[model samples]
Target: MKLGEGVEAAIHCAATLASVAGNSTMPGAALAESFGLSPSYLLKHLNQLTAARILESVPGPAGGYRLARAAERITLLDIVLAIEGREPAFRCGEIRRNGPVKLDASAYIKPCGVNAAMLWAESAYRAVLAETRLSDIVAEYAAEGDPRAFAASCAFVERHQRPQKSNPTKQTPARS
Candidate 1:
C-alpha cells in the first residue's frame, strides 16, 4: 500500500526536530524551506501532528514547533497515525458477496479472506513502524545520510528556532 506524502514529511520533520539541540523548536515556514515544501501543504500535516498530540505548536515570536515527548518515545507509527490517521489503508467493499456470480447472503457468512489479508498487511506495516523511533533514525543518519545535507538541515533549524520557555503552563502548549 502507498503511504501519503504527509506521512513522509512528518517523519522527516520529526527526525530533523530530534537532531536539534535540546530537542528544540522550528517554525512551519523554516521546516518547509528546509525540505523544499510548500508552506500551506506542510502546515496541513503539522496541524494534524499537533491535533494528534505528536507535536506541540507555539504561537507568536519565539514560536515554532516541538515534539510533545522524547524522540525515543516517539515512533514512526506515531507520526504516521498523526498524519495519515488510524484508519486501515485498505478499504474492502465486500465484493466477495456481490457480483454477476453472486453468492447467497447466508453462504457468505464466513469473513472475507481478502479483507482479512489486507488488514493483516496494514497491521504488519504499523507494527514495523511502531518499533522504529526517531532516535533510532538519528543513529542511522551518520551512516545512511549525506553528512553535508544532514548537518545543514540541523543547523538551519537551530539558527531559526527559538526554544520555548519551560513554564508548566507553556509546557503543555495549546494547538495553534
Candidate 2:
C-alpha cells in the first residue's frame, strides 16, 4: 500500500526540527522553501503533525513550530498513525459470501485467510516502524555527515528559524 500524502515530508520536517537548537522554532514558509515544496502543501502536513502532538506551534512574529518532545521518544509508527490514522489499511468485505460459489454460512464464521494474512503483515510493518524513532534517523545522519558541514547546516536552519520567546514584562494578569 502507498503511504499517505505528507508522510515523508512530516518525517523530514521532524528530523530538521530535532537537529536545531532547543526551544527554537521554524516558520512553515522557511521549512517549505528548504524542502522545495509548496508552502500550503507542507503546511497541511505540519498541521497534521501538530494535531498529533509531534510538533508544538508557537504564535507571534518570531513564533513557529518545534517538537513537543524528544525525537527519540517519537516513533515512525506514531507519525504514520498521526497521518494515516489507526484504521486498518486493508478491509475485507467478506466477498466470498457473495460469489457464485455459495458456501455454507457456517464457513463465514471463521476469519478469512486472506484477511488474516493482510492483518498479520500490517502488524509486522507496524512493529518495524514502532522500533524506528526520529532520533535514530538523526543519529544516522550525524554518522554520515561531515562535522563542519552538518554544523553549518544546522546553524543555517537556526539562523533562519524564528525562536518563540515570551516577554517577561508582557505577562497577562491572572483572572480570578
Candidate 3:
C-alpha cells in the first residue's frame, strides 16, 4: 500500500497549521519552505485538502491556509483520503478470469481471496489513521520530538503566520 508523497506533505502542513495562533494563517509558500518542498507541488495537495474541507484557504495578503475545524476534529484519514482519493490501494483486476484455465463466471461466485485479504488489511490501516487526530500528532511531537527541531518550527511559524485583523474597520493611531 504505497501512498503518494503528497500525503506526507499534506499531513505535515496540517500539523503545522495546528500550531498557529488563533485566526492566524500560514501561507502555502511558507509551508512549502518549511518542508523544503516546491510550492507548486504542495499547492495541489493543499487545494485538495481545501476541497475536502480539511483545511480552509483565505484569500489576499492577510490570507493563507488554516484548519477548517479544530485539529481535534481532523483525522489522518481525512488528509489521506483528500490527497490519495477514496480508491482502495489494491485494485483487483480478476486475473483469475484471464488465465487459460478460464472458469465460468459462476465458478467465481465467491470474492477473490487475495482481494478480500487486501481489503481487510486496508480496513485495519484506515482504522488506525481514522483514530489519529491532527491534535494527537501535534501533541505527541510537542511532548517527545527533538527540542531544537520543535523550537525551530515554532520560530518559523511565529515569523510567518499572519493573524487576521480583529476589526478590519478599526485603526490604531500611528506613532512616531
- What clash count goes with each model? 0, 0, 0
Candidate 3: tens digits of C-alpha lDDT, residues 41-123: 99999999999998889899889998888888889999999999999999999998996788789999999999999999999
* Model 2 stretches with alpha carbons more than 4 Å out: 145-152, 166-176
Q: What is the Cα-based TM-score of model 2?
A: 0.86
Better of 1 and 3 by TM-score: 3
Give the per-residue lDDT of model 1 (tens digit) for 1-176: 88899888999887776655553578889889888999999999999988988787878887888877777888899998888878898998987777788767898788889999989988998899999988888778856889997777667866877776677554442211
Candidate 2 per-residue C-alpha lDDT over 33-68 given as tens digits, one digit per residue, 9 for 90 to 100: 877899999998999999999988888888888888
TM-score for each candidate, following the candidate numbering: 0.89, 0.86, 0.93
In model 3, what lDDT does residue 132 have? Answer: 94
Query: What does the lDDT read for residue 74 in candidate 3?
Result: 89
Better candidate by lDDT, 1 or 3? 3
Structure candidate 3, residue pairs in collision: none
List the candidates ranked by lDDT, beginning with the highest.
3, 2, 1
Model 3, C-alpha of 37: deviation from truth (Å): 0.5
User: TM-score: which candidate is best?
Assistant: 3
